[model samples]
Target: MTDRHDHPAAFVDDMSDRAEQIADAAMRLFARYGFKRTAVDDIAKEARIAKATIYLHFKGKDDILRATLQLLGQRVDALCREVMEMKAPFAERLMALLRAHHCTAFLSIGAGDHFAELRAVIDDIAVKERKAFESIFVRYATQLIEECEARGEITLKRPGVDPAALITTLMQASVGAKVGGISYEDYEARLGLFAGVIIAAVLP
Candidate 1:
């Protein structure tokens, strides 16, 4: 579970304007170079502030990475929630949520070029930050499926299939959508196609 400090929207809410500024700079650099390759000086250079200024806001590189990931989490969290509220068909909203969660993330990291770099260190460094956000994502997806079924907008074609199970399928499919050599357009289209398959499988 996520703590108060890990709240998606509030993760950087308490930061001084300057701290947020520095973290934002670090985020772009980390996206470009990966965590290990990004240093305090690099972040400072990206932020166009003195290296000492970064220390005032963060302890070290890892701390900035946490903040960076949190920032990204906040955006995805907000967008997914927004998509869920759209006054559209359940299937339409489901596709939008997939885009909000996965495609936006892919483009945010520059269409998967350095995804391996920043992502590789995240497993070791910001696992909690990642998990907390993912939990919220899963919750939103599950709720969307359940709500659609309750509204009679859709019914599972098979008995004993949990809405959460559909979410699991979507998650797995999103990974394949980002495989090497695909454009953002292709990644986004693949997600829509995958979600459509899931919906069709359960649509009644």
Candidate 2:
């Protein structure tokens, strides 16, 4: 019979830290070598952990990928919140938000062939998480639009243009610009221009 009390209070914390280290190593490998080519042994070697130790934290490669995506999602969410809380004007804040999002996406997927490989590896999970995140993002954008309008920061040129629809279009355009081969700094500048156009279109 083993005594569970033999383990120190830091045992669980240590395990969690080890799990994060493993996930970080896996992310680097996934970025450098495509997910299919990155084996558990490779991750273990990168993290300097025994191959069996990975099992203590993750079921397998798929599970590790899921964990890494979740971490990425949390970081994006935090960035969004930070931008939303800024003291800048609505247009400036919106531009900042779009820039943060695009920059984060580029960093996450633009390194080597990570995006294509990620799409191939966990398409379903990726789609589900993306849709969920986008839904929340759109809602927040709508709220910002409404607040801006109320504050006279913007006024709709066409009263028929639904705030939600306009926000969705802006979000899609921002993403499309990135996929269309524009450089990061250029994309960011375009985001500022886009936000200005949006505000101009709605200005009284």
Candidate 3:
């Protein structure tokens, strides 16, 4: 007789794998021509499968998007966790995680006239998603800040810099670099210096 736990576990694993594949396909298509212009047909073609097959897995295009964004959120959490697990200095781990997020995932997905609609969706979804991301970033950043203070890497006289403000600054800087056409090499150099400065500023 088949063990009930074994069957359920296998079924869940298979579903997760399939969902991930679908998300990957959706990302590629959406990246090519913004999510608004991409159709289920486009995703189906990219995935090399029938449109009906997509329906079997997801409710529709919106469902596909929800899944893709959710996957990204999970990945961000995992990256933060990895950085936190590193034995190096807290500042080093934070820099590594910041650098990882600096690169844009879907280059072709631009704002253009699609900004309003997309922004609305993101704002609503992000209200929830951003909190989760912030929790991860703050947890890691706070630990690093504490470590740096103990080692005299920073000289914070009081509470020092807010972790949320630091994360926002780094994110804005990266976005500005992307907008200004900064080369990867230049961005990396600048990011390193910026990270170091932030560490020093917050260290007490």
Native-vs-model 3 lDDT? 0.65
Question: Runs in model 2 with CA error above 4 Å?
Answer: 1-12, 180-182
What local distance difference test score does each model get? 0.80, 0.74, 0.65
Q: Write the per-residue lDDT of candidate 2 for residues 1-204, one digit (tens) a residue.
A: 855457766677788789888988887888778788899999999999999999999999988988776666677778888887888788777777776665676566544545555656667555666665566567667767787888888776586766876787787776655555456677677667777877777767
Give me the runs in candidate 3 sitting further than 4 Å from their true place: 1-6, 104-121, 124-127, 150-155, 158-160, 180-190
RMSD of each: 6.4, 3.5, 4.1
Residue 91 local lDDT, model 2: 73
C-alpha displacement of 96 in model 2, angstroms? 1.0
lDDT per residue (tens digit) for residues 1-204 in model 1: 778586755756645667878878887776677677788998998899999988878889889888877777888899998998899988888888888888777776636467766666888888998787667669888888888889888887587767777888888787666778589888888888888888787677
Who wins the TM-score comparison? 1
Please provide TM-scores, in order, for all candidate models, with all chains considered together.
0.86, 0.78, 0.73
Minimum summed lDDT over a 10-residue window in model 3 is located at 103-112
Q: Which consecutive 10 residues in model 2 have the weakest lDDT in total? A: 108-117
Candidate 2 to truth, TM: 0.78
